[model samples]
Target: RDNADNTYTESGTRKRMGRKGIGKLAALSVAERVKVISVRDGDKSGCILSLNISNKNADGKYEIPAIPDDQINFLKIDETKSGSAIIMENSRYSINKTIDSAKRNISLIFPFACQTFKIHLENLTTGATATIDDTTMDIVKLSDALLTFSDEDSEYNEYLNALHGAFDNGRYYRVLQEKLPPDQLPAQKVLHKALTTIKEKMLLVTITGEQKAFDLSICGWIATFASSSDKKRNTDFPVNHISIIANDKLGQFDILPDISTDRMGEAYVVGQFFVDLLEETELPDIAASNRQGYKEDDPRFEKTLELIRKNALRPILELKADATKEKNYIRDLEKANKAKESKEAFDRSIREVVEHPDFKKVIHDSQPVKQALETAWELKDTLKDTYKKIMISHSSDDKPVIDELERVLHFCGFEKEEILYSSSNYYESGFEAYTDIYDYLKNFFVNTTRKTDLCVIYILNQGFVEKWDPVLEAGAGWVLNSTWYPMYTDTFSSVRRPFPGTAYTPKLNFDMDEKQSRTLAGAIYRISQHAGKLEQTEETIFQFIKTTRLYHG
Candidate 1:
């Protein structure tokens, strides 16, 4: 097809999908004997095509075999006026493979078959027949996600309806609804939110050293499956293929290898793109040998590849990610809640074992009682002081800094009722609501008559230095000699140098570095250890400080 001498093209209203006239020779490679029959205006002609060209007539042309005209007429219907048919005898192609394979191969190669042009395959030995038409996309009907784009209004609308019907009232939605918790958004809403917008992409690509630019437009549908195995697809035919079609003819069976990012999601993806401009008559031929595919360096082909990668493939994967994150979040939350409830019940039963009637006689010698007593002692050693009330002293302006500290405390196994902050709603129902603010502080901090142990954490910042209430709380901690620590939010340089208002100098590290992370972890570990609420190792808290969004710049 590349050489001028062998290139033969036909003129028609539609662009020709073929250039070279060597398709007849392909039959010789698949079959031993090939019969070609033609009927034009009721005139019949027949020939026996062969790979051996030595049997030629005196005119130096291949010899034609004589056959009866009636034999060719019976192969066609009475209404047919003009058509050609090739019947290969003793075929070598279909012998090794099953009938279904032949059907799938035909479908794979010629995906543009529609109502006007259809292909039918039949197995004479088994009576199995398959027809290819507009329903070629039905193979991907069970896919978990689908994305369709086309410039043509009719085709785009058709595929859009199919997408909505699949997600809104189809198998994926039903499964998610049955599995997910009722409080979360429905699967249909999540998918619809992700796929809310679609846009058509085009690029103007020009040949090298040429001023004329060609417009390349890519259009098609892409599908992704949760599972792509042959058994799941219910067919041995490989369905994870993205075909390229130009002028209603196969250009390449798959272009995914050229455009894929090698992500796992790529294995589940399949689609076809129609780029008619690749076969434009006015442009130089860009197709590879035998129309297998386009030359990779061709500008039009490169732009088409870019369009498919950026527009079509990306959106489908994002939709899958959104749906997966939502489903996993709900499931993980439910599991964590269940684990918390079970841990509480287990702890209560462990406490009851200590109150057993025969506990004292067997506690010293029996293995089971020794184990139970050790467990109870370890639990008491770690969490006995967790009953102490924690007071977080801070200004209202430093709410974000205090909130991060609250989260760290919760992570250390402190409950909502055990920790008190002025801004938190957990303390609103206590006696502090009705009593005077100054009187409540005196009663909470310097009230030696009270039985509860108290620990105060001073939030040292510019706001803390400027406000009266935080300074008063700090003075109370200093006077009562309560266990207290000063945690700085703003850098020490931003506040008074040498720290004027407090008894101890605040640490001068707020930048995100190894030293700062270690300092913060050490402070939190000491607080949790003093309250007997330490649950995680020191290294775990260090890693949390280094990775958390609150500390990252």
Candidate 2:
């Protein structure tokens, strides 16, 4: 068209959609020849023009021939109309020739254009027409396309029905029963479950801000998937990407490396940032020649990068960590539940075997009876030393401290039966209200033979010295020549010495704060290792020593 000469010009002063003058070369890049037809207002006729883009002379110049007015064909034109048409021939570049593929590519590249412009497409051979608008590119349509399985027959329908049933009723096993004929149902079920997990773990965040430095309005949404598989299935887009869009067109597809080097975090994240300022004519041009990326050193680019890091990347990392923690917690609960079930099953089997009629008969036989008695004797001897390895002596008033110490011993790998304490067994045997304190202590230490072989840990406080039973317990320890480790509280400092010999004791203050409690835990752990009740390792011992110094400082 006569008005279309502006596109072929080298430069212009007015604002324009495209700045480069070489856009017309795109036609040559695609086809070997191009034809142009035009009509203008007030013109009596239309004119046709052609260019041989593929022709070249020996001097490497295109051989474009000039056509005289006599050679040009003219047709009647509408007086009030003006328009131009272009036809490319002998295309050199690949293109999506199908109607659907072409439509999709146009929708993805110029979504906003499809909404504003009256674009109509027609198949010349079939006489079929398609109209594209905003609805044609809606995300809902995309989601439906993704969910549609390749097979359209009843088998795929059954799979979808089972999936829906499983979701509605929370009965996956029932759905698994409705397997497909070709045994593809299990794989589908796995994919469905993985997708469900992804939905459960997915995180979405929206960031909106006005950056005054660039005078730009920025808005974006970042979403994370549960697994790499889920992400791959959901999109062919690059993983862990932050796409930058200007005027609804992608300028940069990925900025992940600029944000962080955390590969584990990158796999789950994908998003886009909309900033129309990059397309403004008032700003210095930063877009690359091919329109694929921005100049790295541009101030606008730097500011946008900073905004994305602060608002998007930080929150994504935190959300990912929280999701991982929640997943681990669920897994641990499932494992514990399974272990409980296994234990119950084992106990039931043992009871069933013992109650069998044949088992009763075997028990009554002389040979079996003799063997059972011998086995019982052997078991008793084997556990005898193990049961008397550690004796814990404390006043009842110090129960809290002793309880905590018992926990520490367990943490250091001591079993429940190996620990001997007065409150656990003494009261059950009616020793709590015994009239003679020394009698109880003498029987507990001498008759049991716990004093000579076992390590005795004394929880020393004012109550231990003031009360007769605790003093008698200490006297018993002296009589049995047991190895004693004193754990003294603040109350013990004000009381008279129960023993004459002066030796340093590990001091603990009552009503301890968190740090002090950790120190006490460390101290108990160390004493247990020294007394041969816990195994020793250099790393464990060093950690304990470091913790013990917290209260001291």
Candidate 3:
């Protein structure tokens, strides 16, 4: 009876769960009274110790009375020679619920207890009973399964081979390893080695750190199901938690907050951190009275947290980030490759159409042909907008007029990026001295892959005819069989004429009032609409030339 009563009466030093000597008070808080019965070898019958915690003295403290052996209640006992039983009576909490909570708490906190002893619970009302054992818990089962295989066994060997295969296959893991510091590789290798040897479907990662001043070695293993699929295989312990183990027993059942910010990683990870240095007698008691967590400022506790963040959590997060980037890169590469293939197929189709004898016959007759031609022009535009669709071929002296024309084109909704013009200095200095101006222009037009549809607007003036570069540029346009529009300045009386067949090319006057600017802009817009399809009406061409004559006269 004395031993049974003393179970909750005495305080003790640190045990496997830490220095939490007040755990017995939990029973007192839930129930009004506690009854302990014992059967010793010397006693003929069992003696019972009863304590009524609800009845307190004037000072709000319970006055427990001392009962002599003769005055103690005696009960018959047939189960064991020396045993004790605790029966909490008139309980404020439900018996079934308390038993359920006790089972879970025992499994988590004292996982090793079932290895050496047996624990059983019975429901008095329903006559149902449950046995709590090591096999009932996931962590205990996983730990046992891991120890089942020897390192030399085929099962272990197969696991190591598969692990290496997986490591080699994972693109992100390779990237992560390459990015980590050289010194950190050894530790990562150790973790990989430890993981491959594990027999169960769990990835066991070991993280270790040394703090010399406190004589602390933060060492632990984070065991998570090898993948999310592995976790879904079991549902008994569905709640995700990372148990904090000091020595071999659990201190805090959930240390997820210190480990991961990502919910997916948190849900799959279940681990135990061993910080035996925290249990040293000289160190201050940092473990909470419930044994669920540690005090915020505990040095050993703080060191363990630091080690976990730096050695384990940080690496995992970085690997995930790298994996995400690699995945995005692959997706983008796939998109670009598809676009390239589509462009190649499109360019081939355009080449077939332009080379066909009936292509020009269908250009104005069929809408589909015109649309295909426009698509071909736009596809070529992707290479270099400068030379593909529209280019202003002019001398440096024609800058003011050409700039105004460019501004008017832009005002008429033409993208400025699509227009190309080179200054006299750019033509001389930008190109190789040996490179002919005509050769440079031909390369520019051909590089765009749209020489057939390229439209060149020539600014004709005294400077334009005198300059060899401008004359060569115009001849290059003719050599490519491109559409050319000659715009001469009103001040220039004499102009170098184009060849007989090219004399019918549309001509515009450079000197422009607001009305002439609008007229020029409208005519350019009308020509551009048909230039892409290589089609222009005689009436539109005549109107453009007539407008130029009206403005010049």
Candidate 4:
């Protein structure tokens, strides 16, 4: 069960055909009549191995037959980008079996791929994940728990860091209270420290066995709500969602004393508090150490409002006439201050592009100048440095042109590696193909393990009318912008589709110079230089495509 291998192997023990762990060892023997209808992608790469078994075969040894070429399935190939997607299939998996395994093989295997589970379990029989009832399930406690957790897993380590930050924040929010608990400060700090280490875009999470075990109720909800949807049932199992839906579900949030556009970031910070809380539910004992973390200030601030409820404010204000206008003005001033602070924080977070002195020579007066400066200062922290990257923009129909361009880049000193093409080697259609492309691209965007420094797009007159090309080009431009700003008109929304009867839709620019690789490479190079990241050689960026794809240098 290596992290890199998405497949499962017999680990602890092996057993006879009728016993427990046998299925994990290898495919079982099956009748000669076993058919091989299956799912595959159009790609000639990224293949996975699958085995099938039946109860009838008398010999224990696998008398396996090769899957025919006709039985093999392929994923859709995107003509516009390099990525992967989720592959769906129609099959006769019994209720006891998963799509990927038979009913009897579940504990050793599963319905979907083994990669979906955090740790091996008897889920094959249980229908629900086993739940544990430790206090570590509390977000605050888990933040505390992370102190003992080292960075063995970068993703989990980051989760621990965010928890430290959350506790720190709890203390800061306590300042407004009159009798704030003394422990509130450190509890908040602990969580805050844990939060700072998370990568920005990761969405999926898996809990190992020793990690927090949720309640059967929670597990049911996670399976139905978080896991794959049930197409035939048109619904998944449900659980008690009421507890998870409370207004102060995690904790309190405060308006930053005033309302200002600048304070918007504060509001965001306030809202994100909930996310960090839920993420750390794995470690419960930390709460025992954090005795003062969940303390609250007295609620006596309601006393000031009691006067108004009792109709005393009008009379008091009348008696103190001069203070009325002053109080009103002060309230307005507070709002203005909050807005300023919010914007300042937001700017600080999104602005981190590196702008060495050389950037001015490329993108003079770029708006992300402050970001560039910060990037320059943090130059030592970058993963790689000074690698050349070339971006290609072209049409799919001009595959030959791209290939020639790539050949030229190779000749010009670009390696056959490090290139990211968005135009030629992607899925055009098919379930398996779609999944393959989606996975690759999503990981590139969300995981720390995979990211592209340069972007290339192919534009053809006929290709411009389709949706994928412009969608990818916008994505590339966005990456170069370094600010990760979403486009309204220019970008194709992944969440929403184009509406029917709409009066307008964006038309992609259909024309481009066929041999402009050098110019395009220069622009991409500029982006790499600004980020102070490893630069890809223009030749390397172009060569891989030359071997098979149409887009070249």
Best by TM-score: 1
Runs of candidate 2 with Cα error greater than 4 angstroms are 1-15, 33-87, 111-114, 117-119, 128-131, 135-213, 220-243, 248-250, 253-272, 313-340, 343-553
Could you list the CA RMSD of all candidates, in the order they appear? 12.8, 17.6, 22.0, 30.3
Residue pair clashes in candidate 3: none
lDDT of 4 by residue, 142-225 (tens): 121122122434333443343344332332234423344454322222122122221123222333345332221011000011
Deviation in Å, model 2, residue 216 alpha carbon: 3.9
Q: Where does model 1 exceed 4 Å of error?
A: 1-13, 25-29, 32-34, 60-71, 74-76, 92-98, 152-170, 179-210, 229-237, 323-334, 346-553
| lDDT tens per residue, model 1, 262-295 | 4446777777777777775555677776557889
Best first by lDDT, ranked: 1, 2, 3, 4
- Cα deviation of 221 in candidate 4 (Å)? 73
How high is each candidate's TM-score? 0.56, 0.39, 0.41, 0.18
**Lowest summed lDDT over 10 consecutive residues: which window, candidate 3?**
141-150
lDDT of 2 by residue, 1-553 (tens): 0133552334653324554444456566667766555557633332222344466699998765443434333333343586555666787867756666556555444433334464566677776666677522233211111111112332224433332233222123243445324443332221111111000111212123223333444554444555666445322334446677675556677777777534355567655556655655444567776666788877667767776776666555555544443434335446647855875586589668766789767776678675876664454344322235567777887665565555446445455555766665334322345446555455456544532436777777765778876777777886777766667766446334544323334555544555555545555665666556555443453333332322333
Q: Which stretches of candidate 4 lie over 4 Å from their true place?
A: 1-394, 422-435, 448-462, 469-473, 476-553
Q: What's the CA error at residue 148 for candidate 1, in Å? A: 0.5
Which is the better candidate, 2 or 4, if ranked by TM-score?
Answer: 2
Q: Rate the local accuracy (lDDT) of all candidates.
A: 0.63, 0.51, 0.50, 0.31
Q: Could you give candidate 3's per-residue lDDT for residues 1-553 as a string of tens digits?
A: 0122332323543233435456446556766656555657745233222344455689998756443555434443454466655666677755435556557655555543444456676666666666675422354223211111114433224433333333322433354466555554322221122331122121211123322244454444443343455555423344445555565456666766764543344455554445555554334556776656777566556666666655655444334333334434445446647856876797799788786877677577888878887875664554432323567777877675555565444333244434656642233214445756565575576564444545677777666767887788787776766777766654334345563223333344554454544455455766466444223333333333332323342
Candidate 3's clash total is: 0
What's model 2's lDDT at 81? Answer: 80
